[model samples]
Target: MIEETPQEVQVVEGVLLAHGIEPRTHWFEASTATALEAAAALGVDVGAIANSLVFRLDEEVIMIIASGAHRVDTHLLGEWLGGIVTRASADMVRRSTGQVVGGVSPVGHPERLRTLVDVSLGAYERVWVSAGHPHAVFPTTFEELLRLTGGTAALVARD
Candidate 1:
């Protein structure tokens, strides 16, 4: 297990503190890079794991916090956003969010990104999200996620 908190995760903790939230971070020995891994490590349903997805809309980068059980339909997302949506390159993801692909948190981006939170996540009372590290995660509610990321609630996933 990683005994030390990563600097990236510390930044996320700082952001959460700035938002008046006490960080409750969980670190795992194995990589919780994927939603399934995170769910397994946390002993929660897959749907309760919030997946932070980065996409490119024209020249802008956007974030979609979708439930682990769902897949973001890029075509539908593009239609809703009035532009085609493509997966953001790893470099773009890192530069825009100041974190690695597997560890991107909803907060602590270089700038405020346009974010969409999947309404499906509302089914769970508590959800787990990445805490800026592949081995770290934090529990949060759907409403809290919306508030923290300034994200609009939407149907971002495919059925």
Candidate 2:
């Protein structure tokens, strides 16, 4: 287990606090690097785990908070956003969000990224999101997530 909160998680906590949210970050001894791992750790359904995915839409980086049970259809997303959506490289992800893949959060980026929250996430009353670290996560409702990230609600994933 981490002896202290990491700087990345602290930044996420700061963002949460700035938005009047009490950060209840959960740190795990084992790696919560995948949605399945996180869900197992939390004893929640996999669908309740929100996966923060970074994509390059043409020249701009965008974030999509998709449900763990779903996979994003990049072509569909591109049609909706009017750009070709491609999976971002690790370098691009780090440069854009200052967080690594499998640990990217909805907020706490160097700059506000255009974000979309998967509408299917609304099915869960409480959803767990990565708290800027592979071993950390936090709970939030779908509405709260949208408000926190200024994200639009959309069907970002394939059924």
Candidate 3:
């Protein structure tokens, strides 16, 4: 675990403490979609990575905390959101969500962005999320993330 803590560490820590969980912080080298890279870097299971994905819902941006094992069904989400859902570009991601692709955290945005969680993530007892920095990550439970993000848990993935 890296002790320097991330710039967005405050948001994660605040949310965790509000929920009565004192989580331990960990940092990694490369932050990417390849959960294996993060896992190998952190020496944890690939399943533990919580990939913070952002999509354009209509003109608004929406965030989805999905398990590393599943891919988001953007078309389904678009239908649910009643608009065209598309994968946000890197510029769109930072502009709308105030975070980067791999280092996007479930919280600490400029404001609350409408968010959701993959129901499949509930299968995990704990998950790792980006800590507002590409080199930082931290652990939290699936339930905690849903509550913290104020996001509804739904089937956002499919085979």
Winner by lDDT between candidate 2 and candidate 1: 2
TM-score, each model?
0.97, 0.98, 0.84
Q: Which digits, one per residue and each the tens of the lDDT, describe model 2 over residues 1-159?
A: 788888889999999999999999999988888999999999999999999999989999999999999999999999999999999999999999999988999989999999999999999999999999999999999999999999999998667
Cα error, residue 82 of model 2, in Å, equals 1.1
Per-residue lDDT value at 102 in model 3: 73
Q: Where does candidate 3 have its weakest 10-residue lDDT segment?
A: 25-34
Provide the overall lDDT of each model, using Cα atoms, as 2-decimal numbers: 0.93, 0.94, 0.76
lDDT by residue for model 3 (1-159), tens: 356665566766676677777756665546543566677787777767888888888778788887787788888877777888888899988876566777788887877888888887677777878776677777778787878889888778776
* Segments of candidate 3 deviating more than 4 angstroms: 1-6, 14-20, 30-33
| Clash count in backbone of candidate 2 | 0
Sort by lDDT, best first: what order? 2, 1, 3
Any idea what lDDT model 3 has?
Answer: 0.76
Q: List clashing residue pairs in candidate 1.
A: none
Q: Count clashing residue pairs per candidate.
A: 0, 0, 0
Candidate 1's residue-wise lDDT over 1-159, tens digit each?
776777888889999999999999998989899999999998999999999989999888999999999999999999999999999999999999999999989988879999999999999999999999988999999999999999999998778
